[model samples]
Target: MNDWPPVRVLEAAPRWLRKVKAIILREIGSRYTGDALGYLWAYLVPLAWVLAVYVIFLLLGRRIPIDTDIGSFICSGVVPYVCSRYAVNAILRSRTAYRHILSFPTVSPNLVGGAVFALEMVNSLLIFGFLLLLNYSVFGFFEMHDPVLALWGYFLAVTSGGAFGYLMASLSTIVPALSRATPIFLRPLFYISGVFYTANELPPTLRDLFVWNPLFHGIEILRNGLFIGYESLFAMAWVPITFILVCVATGYIVQRRRLSGAPVEGDASWAI
Candidate 1:
């Protein structure tokens, strides 16, 4: 006769959490495996963008009409835009990138996408820190009127990008054409998202229209945080927050159904 206590049962929520953590680590490792610079590139890429934009403005002999310095204005906008772009692209590619790994029961497409999104969040934070240092050292001015609000705005921006990316990921699986068309769709947003200018610069009607774009609100919130007198009076934080929540909720529903062995609408064989 053999006597043994029953094996401890792991709760489903905790098990999934563990799986997500493992996936995040594995993906980070794979992304930087052969690269010498590795994660340093994350910080460097944003810095390059900021510098490039600053130089362009300087060459054009155009000064930012805002109260804040040029460096603060540029960095505030560039960092958030870069983070949003990278986060969305990374999530859009997650399904295809981890298709094989997603075959495992514990590894779902949502998990892979979530892990990639989480990685982007971490990278964005690091980039923000680096920008702060650069702004302080080179520009000799870096003031945060509301650091907490700034961080909250940054989080919303990144989350909104990831949520939109998840929506795109789900749709691309249904309509293969979307996979090829996403970048083309996002091209217009670069100019329209208040990346190079502030929302307050616009006329009343134009500002009204621009504030609807979640990205504009994000940049405004970020600037408000960085500048002492700069207040984004037109932006209502709830708008982006609601949009992201809706996207995330819808994405979760679709992902859950897909993972439950339901056939995709257009492609039955599409297993993610």
Candidate 2:
């Protein structure tokens, strides 16, 4: 008879999935452990932001063809945009924040970022659900034109954003200057990413300027998916896939070369 397989390594694929699931749970628990509202805050924070943006834009007297009520339209774009941005930031900092954990057995650096992405996705889903409930109850904006397309867009945006975050995290680890100037670097992206408005509404000059902003493309794809009644100008699959590949490739190269561990302008960690 053939020798039986070992219990510890019964099947590599299932074991790997189990490990990833554990990591995701651990991250989520650590993040919301003592909070009274717990994960409810995740839904609240984005909702609050969306409300603020809608009021601000309303006061400013600017409008676009969102094809839905103001709240839902704002939420459709903002939820995905905020989720992607937070995921990127969290993943970018994971390596540094949990460097000690990496010393443990079976803990890969990629897992560090993956856990962050998973947690962010969870929060995003909660926000999306809340939006759906509100849309149905308040505005009757329960138009589900293409559920599959919406899911695809949301997933693609998160994946591409997370990949880019990994790339940025790796680079910042090598170049500490970036770590010190984080907010300064990301602020401009907020205005240019088409998060608050439709890309078509942007002036011709501004539109051309933002055309090269990959985040804008990703957000537009997400908006098109969420705003069911509206049509998108760009191809969803092609833009997201190309952007994801570029970010993933750059991140892989940095990881393989151990570039993230390299020294930078400052920090003793550089000497290590």
Candidate 3:
């Protein structure tokens, strides 16, 4: 007699990666199922946003401030804002939404949250790519002067978004009432962030006031990297970077405590 089949086990790193990929696929599946528009719907949202903002600015008699096209200018700012906002919402909801899966020891909320982080980052890129094509078509020019800075800025936006997500998720674990409150906190950010105008263009009094928002810094850094003519004078690189680190550290501690303090059978503890 001989062995009819062979079994192989993956090492830890590969196994972890495999699990992450499966979780990401599961997330995508659940999100798109039964939606007739499917993936096309994802691209439409950002497009509509950019179009609406651009039109609103145009109607308000806003002139193009620099040599860059208005569409590209808005894209640089809006893309990061949209990506950051989307990431925060997705990460915040994953806890209550995936509580059943977290009961398994091998699958922690950290692992699931990491998967959501990666998924949203990919979605950020796809959505950005679609907007780039649209900008090119409408404006006939698309140039990124500093790809490295561009990428770094985009990374900061998404990471900061994830960082805030963790904070909100941790809060939801305690208050429960705030579990669905991401939108209420986030809605005001849309106007304050530099999606429609640059920091320098704002009145001196207003510029100092709005610069407090880290997303404003994120957008300014992105525009500085993308447009040669724009200088993000108000963007202090340290602010958003520090914001990301602190939020993640604090949120990680809370999440770890929650995970370790509860037994596997007590699914109620897993509730956000």
Candidate 4:
């Protein structure tokens, strides 16, 4: 008889999934415990950003020539951008934040990182839903030409963001200095990631350069879904998908090596 313990293997699979879920729930609960505002901040902060951008555009007498209202257009871009940004920042701190949990042999760093990613994805969904409701009610802007396509774009943005966050988390663990500089490096992405403008609006040369940006593709694909007549000539779905897979693979390798007590380049004292 084989001593492989097939029954135990089956049992352990569900147990591991349950553990990941428990970690996610615990993180969400602990994150908003002391704050009275709780999860409302997740929706409110993004809503506030949309309103602020709308007002700024109004003041500047600038208007997007798209079929939908400016508010809706901005919402499509900003929501995903914010979600990805926060996901990266949160994941970067996940390993250190959950260091105590990592002591258990069953709880790997990747599992903890997955928990953090789940928390951000949940928050992003809430924020996205709230924005949709607000836009429909306040601005009467519910012109979703292709809901499936739009959803696919949103999915890509969130997943890619989570993967990028995981990568940053792994990098920061090995290089402490990167932990400090990550935010600064990410600041410029907001302006360039097609958050404020569509790829079509840029000149041909500029559009060529911007097309290489993965987030820009996400925003443009999202716009294609929201606005009926809008065409995103530069949007390529495979680019971001490829980038996400690469980031995730690299992050996983680095995380596994570090967790296995292998020697990592730079100071790994920051991990704890």
C-alpha positional error of residue 269 in candidate 4 after TM-score superposition, expressed in Å = 13
Candidate number of the best TM-score: 4
Candidate 2 C-alpha lDDT tens digits along 179-231 = 55765756787687777777777788888887776667766766666676677
Estimate the TM-score for candidate 2. 0.83
- Global lDDT of each candidate: 0.79, 0.71, 0.80, 0.80
Candidate 2 wrong stretches, greater than 4 Å: 1-10, 34-36, 259-272
lDDT of 1 by residue, 20-132 (tens): 88877876787766366887777788889999999999999977857878888888888888898888888987777788887775576777888789888998888888888
TM-score of 4: 0.89
Q: lDDT of candidate 2 vs native?
A: 0.71
lDDT of 4 by residue, 1-272 (tens): 34569977776888888998898778767776636587777678888888888888899998886777887888988999988888887887776778887767567778888878887887887788788888899878777889888878877888778888888888766787886787886787788888888887888988877777778888888888878979887889998899899999998887756544764675353244
**CA lDDT of 192 in candidate 1?**
74
Clashing pairs in 1: none
- Model 1: how far is 86 from its true place, Å? 0.7
- TM-score between candidate 3 and the true structure: 0.88
